[model samples]
Target: MFTRLGVGVFIWVAASAAVADPVLQQPIDCTLGETCEIQQFMDHDPEQGEQDFACGAASYDGHKGTDFRINVPDMDKGVAVLAAADGVVAGLRDAMTDRRVVLAEDQTAVAGKECGNGVVLRHGDGWETQYCHMKLGSLVVTKGQKVTAGQKLGEVGLSGKTQFPHLHLSVRKDGVPVDPFAPDRDGQTCAYDAQHTLWAKAFAKGFIYQPGKVIDIGLADRGPDLADVVDGRWSDFVADPNAPLVVYGLAVNGLAGDQMQLVLTGPDGEVVNVTQDRLGKRQAQWFAFAGKRPPQGGWTAGDYDLTVRVLRDGKLLHERKSQVQLTR
Candidate 1:
């Protein structure tokens, strides 16, 4: 039975020699780095270690697919998953419940169905693409149905062996897992080569590799929680003058020794600025926040700006800014 280790980490067979490459399109219908982010990539390292196509630790060991993740609020609104290439649907599943696998029992429930409600397409020449973690009952294609590139197959979801909502896209050649970013095994260098990529010209240019990324940032009335951030609840929160003004940032692929800094500035001047402790080890996801309670007059009604930055070796790696209005 197929099994997953962590967030979308799955097993794969050995890769085969190169074959005809499939000209792929963006599989998710959302603005990259805005409504969605590429949280993980296919593991390029063949050993127990993990590495993305850019030689970064964004991928987990044995990860067989590239994970295109969306914030939970966006998932709730529905984000379509598109076919990456012209193909015939080989198989599909749509009955699984849309829920994250966080506990041991949840893992057992999805044991062999680690791909969740997914669709498999055969693009001929021994090339095939599998789209996993689709929302339950959102599949629009059926077995043997012909689909064109960019056609909607389903919506991304928190299903099967995943801890978050994402579309896990896997490319296989002759039933062997292949990295679409680095299709040719011979050209598996850390640097991206347009000649070796499967993405179409337009899409290839947008899939820039990043070692770290700030996925979300927001201003809240109180300290933010990881669950609340993942659920995207902070986006709707309204702050009053009497409440504490907090700013939180959510990031992915935080390497060891990385530090996160949060700063808030009011109409008057700087309010709160704090740098979190260095991460002791690699973290798939990291959350940090800083804030201050209301002053004697209750925070002066005005506009507040929050700046969040991730630093590695004292060098800025990623930064995000957000603004919120405080009313009396």
Candidate 2:
């Protein structure tokens, strides 16, 4: 596992070139409510990978980095750039025609991964991190400063030859960029890092994220805006026993036989019912299903647990849960 050890502490030492823990890998920041316009993908989203059209050649003669945008719908001013791991900062480049810098070195490195602002910090396990395109002087974390996971190395800004403000975070295992979506080396940076990553660009300056309220989470400018309809969702559960609680949303993720499942269980240690619905494979859809449709004998109404799972190849990639109070 990848743990951001403090300075001077090398926990996992490699014989020659040890690989960092895949599970500890930190992804580019794409948190809830933050919009990330992903110009590329790793191994996980292959279809998306195919759709990703490269505008120009790779690195333009050894520039050593890909370009991306944070065209998140509803965001206009963009978000802040941040560091993915802890390490000694190096490779600070500036004054180029496009105006970009690179901090290359961190423990989490999977192939096909793109971490902007490229801040590489050397640590134990022969690993390093890369944060790309900071806002000129926004990088508060200086070289030689030991940083922890989620530490604000700098704020995301449209600097360093980038069109938007999103961290193009990547990792170097044994001195090479690694994919951020590979499962074999998943979590190569943070042992306790399970939350999904997000990167958003500016859409509209006035829109603010209200947490509980549903927000448009999609990269509209990049073609196919998969809102809750054309997309899928992560939402609260409705436990109104009066009717089979309805769950619906939209998203452009998951494969066939992968519908949203709602797991309902009462206070007692008993499994009442496992709700499963096929989301199908489409850009977007308005989905709505009753947890317990008032069928023949009528559905029982009571407090229960609801777990929404997105399944594919008999695996749950995404899932969410909420409590509901059912009624007769």
Best by the lDDT measure? 1
lDDT value for model 2: 0.38
Question: How many pairs collide in each candidate, listed in order?
Answer: 0, 84
Q: Which segments of model 1 are wrong by more than 4 Å?
A: 1-19, 185-188
TM-score of 1: 0.92
Candidate topping TM-score: 1
- Cα deviation at 294, candidate 1, in Å, is 1.7
Candidate lDDT values, in order:
0.85, 0.38
Give residue 130's error in model 1 in angstroms.
Answer: 0.3
lDDT accuracy of residue 104 in candidate 1: 93
Instruction: Summarize candidate 1's per-residue lDDT along 1-328 as a digit string, tens digits.
Output: 2222124334444444345568889999999888889999988777798988778898998988899999888898899999999999988888889998888999999987888888889999988989999999899987889999999998999877888999999888877778887766453456887666888888787666778988888888787789988998888988888888888999999999999999999987898899999999999999998888888888888898988999999999988887888878
